[model samples]
Target: MLSVSGDVSASTNFTLAQIQALPANTQTVSFGSGTGQQTHVYTGASVWTLLNQVGIATNPAVKNDVLGKYVVATGSDNYRAVFPMGELSPDFGNRGNQVVYAETLNGTSAALTSTDGPLRVTAPGDIKGGRYVSNLAKLEVHTATSTATATGGGVTTQFQLSGAIAHPATYDLAALQALPAVTRTIGANTYTGVSLWDLINASGIQTSATVKNDLLGFYLVATGSDGYRTVISLGELSPDFGNQPDIVAYSMNGAPLPGTGFARLVIPNDGKAGGYVSNLVALEVVSAPR
Candidate 1:
């Protein structure tokens, strides 16, 4: 059995047969003699699918925390390697590159050699077999401390974004305004800034078929400077879905505003101002608890 840990809702153990039961992918790789001619087909499960089974955020739009995330694949011999989650994330532009937990080598009925596997990683596009971990014993998902940095454009960004994404980006007033403009009239105020959806995309979370399929589990939770938080669904950010005209407000009434949270968040869809986050310290994409 293989142990999976870190950033998961619950630790899990899986047998070789169980791993094979998940969705599988196939690839051909050649390593012997370093001539790239001795090729063999590798087939196993998608790492993303495995993460999803353990409830590790898997939405394309939700994005992971800005802190960063990586997966550590270790072998029974103690050899290991780390890969950024984004490389395996479909939304991060590496769409077809799949890092799979391989069970079968060469043919459907042919299992991996005892020296190489009952399981191993079939690293996508990796020419070096160094990434092809054998006798897989554990897979640990790791996350880094989210770092928020303001652009030189006179913006001081402190808040972070996390969820099913790879990178979290911070923006200041000038930086926020630098994004595509979406001006709208809210309660007693005409706000101009980027749409909340655009801001989320700027943080590296994007819409893909996978994201659309998993929208029900996705939400945005904004933390205000006052320590208050409000959650919004991914569908709510779309016009066809909820038609919410939410935005990260930079200028109120079309005039330069001097304030603590220069780039504030406004929820025009909410009847009450309870969802209005003033001085948002953090804007995160989260997956609803399974």
Candidate 2:
């Protein structure tokens, strides 16, 4: 099985049929012996398409944080090769059909050799196939951090946004509720605050046109006053923009917290509160390196 994880709103484990179900592209790239190299046809989905489906940062605004990210493809034999996120994205830098998770070799009517696939990753541009891994089993992102730890939290009284953002923005209880309101139910309680994306938008960190291709590496790191931390993708928090589930709460059950916790982060549709953190103190939007 070929699966996807990391820095995404939803993780997808793909079967052969499932992989084939996605948009497919056919490319003719050179692949043969040194004495007489020959061309071969590859049919598979684009890395950019897959990255977008699973939620990667593709906006132009987050490039400073998007650059240097990479993807790690691990094969069944445990062999792995790294592909820079920039090299696989249209906006960043992808040449021809340079990187593809090839499912069909020769033609759609021909099956990949037993050793070649169920699913194999091929870089058509390489003179040697050392990085063209076969029997691919997993693909995941790795984040690279270039920023120092943020300061000024000695006695935090509000919420803060950091990471891939252009300028850090802070929000008090009133400021949080002032943006917009969305009420959602979790178990037996109802909670309210602006969606987490609202706070992100206010922070000036955004998905710009050119940055969209290399977005999957960015994340929303939520930390609480009690040291409990939870991570979520920026995609899930974007409404009409990405997927669902971006909420921060100032009121529980239609009212403020009971003499405790200034605010809460709630992810709806989940049965547990593991990712739903309370007493939120900080939200960082750092990029993940490949």
Judging by lDDT against the true structure, name the best candidate. 2
Q: What TM-score does candidate 2 get on C-alpha atoms? A: 0.51
TM-score of 1: 0.47
**Clashing residue pairs, backbone N/CA/C < 3 A, model 1:** 63-163, 63-164, 63-165, 64-162, 64-163, 64-164, 64-165, 65-162, 66-168, 67-146
Q: How does each model score on TM-score?
A: 0.47, 0.51
Question: Model 1: residues >4 Å from true position, as ranges?
Answer: 31-37, 57-67, 93-108, 145-290
Candidate 2 lDDT over 124-217, as tens digits, reads 5554454566788888866544332323333345867777778887778877767878888777888877777777767776454654323333
- How does each model score on lDDT? 0.61, 0.62
lDDT of 1 by residue, 16-83 (tens): 77887887777766543345435667777777777768876433453244214556677797666554
Provide the clashing-pair count of each candidate structure.
10, 23
Residue 105, candidate 1: how far off, in angstroms?
7.2
